[model samples]
Target: MTEAPATIMLNGKSRKIKQPCSATELLSELGWKPTQVVIEHNGQVIPRSETGAIMLREGDQVEIILPVAGG
Candidate 1:
């Protein structure tokens, strides 16, 4: 039997993602680059260098913020 996809709370919305996904992988799946945004996992800000090491679990809360160019 196939395993159910993991569900995470992304930006306050429910999103289904593959199992064993890392923060970096999530970014890739969302068509985003690591350098282009900041990530907050479970209410904590995740450093860019640590994104690859952080694994995303079901019910995880993630917030992705992109830097604005305008003043």
Candidate 2:
């Protein structure tokens, strides 16, 4: 079987995920809702629809910023 693409970092660590994946798919894999997390690629906020359109590649920097409610 062919190898999948290398993992993209969540914050500063390497993340290993199978290939043929998109931003939406990644969130699904983590069991997180699109509303719960914010995705930043190359320092840009990508829209939800763009998730499916944006295919991940090796050495790509992905920062998944999420919100937490607390008082």
Candidate 3:
């Protein structure tokens, strides 16, 4: 099995991704909408418009937290 290229903490869980991809790349790859997901980098929240311009570094911590439709 191929090892992961990047490791990020997602909601207290460690996620190993294929590579250090931008938020836009990751979201599109996962079939998620940038507008619907909340993306945080190093505890700082970023807007959806920034996703495409932000470049990810190795060992960088990315948090993807989203809101659910439930009461």
How many clashes in each candidate?
Answer: 0, 1, 0
Q: What lDDT tens digits, residue by residue, belong to model 3 across residues 1-71?
A: 65458777756777766755778887787788898898888778888888887766666678877998898
lDDT of 2 by residue, 1-71 (tens): 86677777767789887786788888888898877788897678998767778777777788888777878
Which ranges in model 1 have alpha carbons more than 4 Å from their true place? 1-3
The best-first sequence of candidates by lDDT reads 1, 2, 3
Name the candidate that leads on TM-score: 1
lDDT of 1 at 24: 98
On the 0 to 100 scale, the lDDT of residue 8 in model 2 is 79
Better of 1 and 3 by TM-score: 1
Winner by lDDT? 1
Measured over all alpha carbons after superposition, the RMSD of each candidate to the real structure, in angstroms, is 1.6, 2.0, 3.5
Instruction: Go through the candidates in order and give each one's C-alpha lDDT.
Output: 0.93, 0.79, 0.77
Candidate 1 on 10-38: residue-level lDDT in tens?
99999998888899999998899999999
Clashing pairs in 1: none
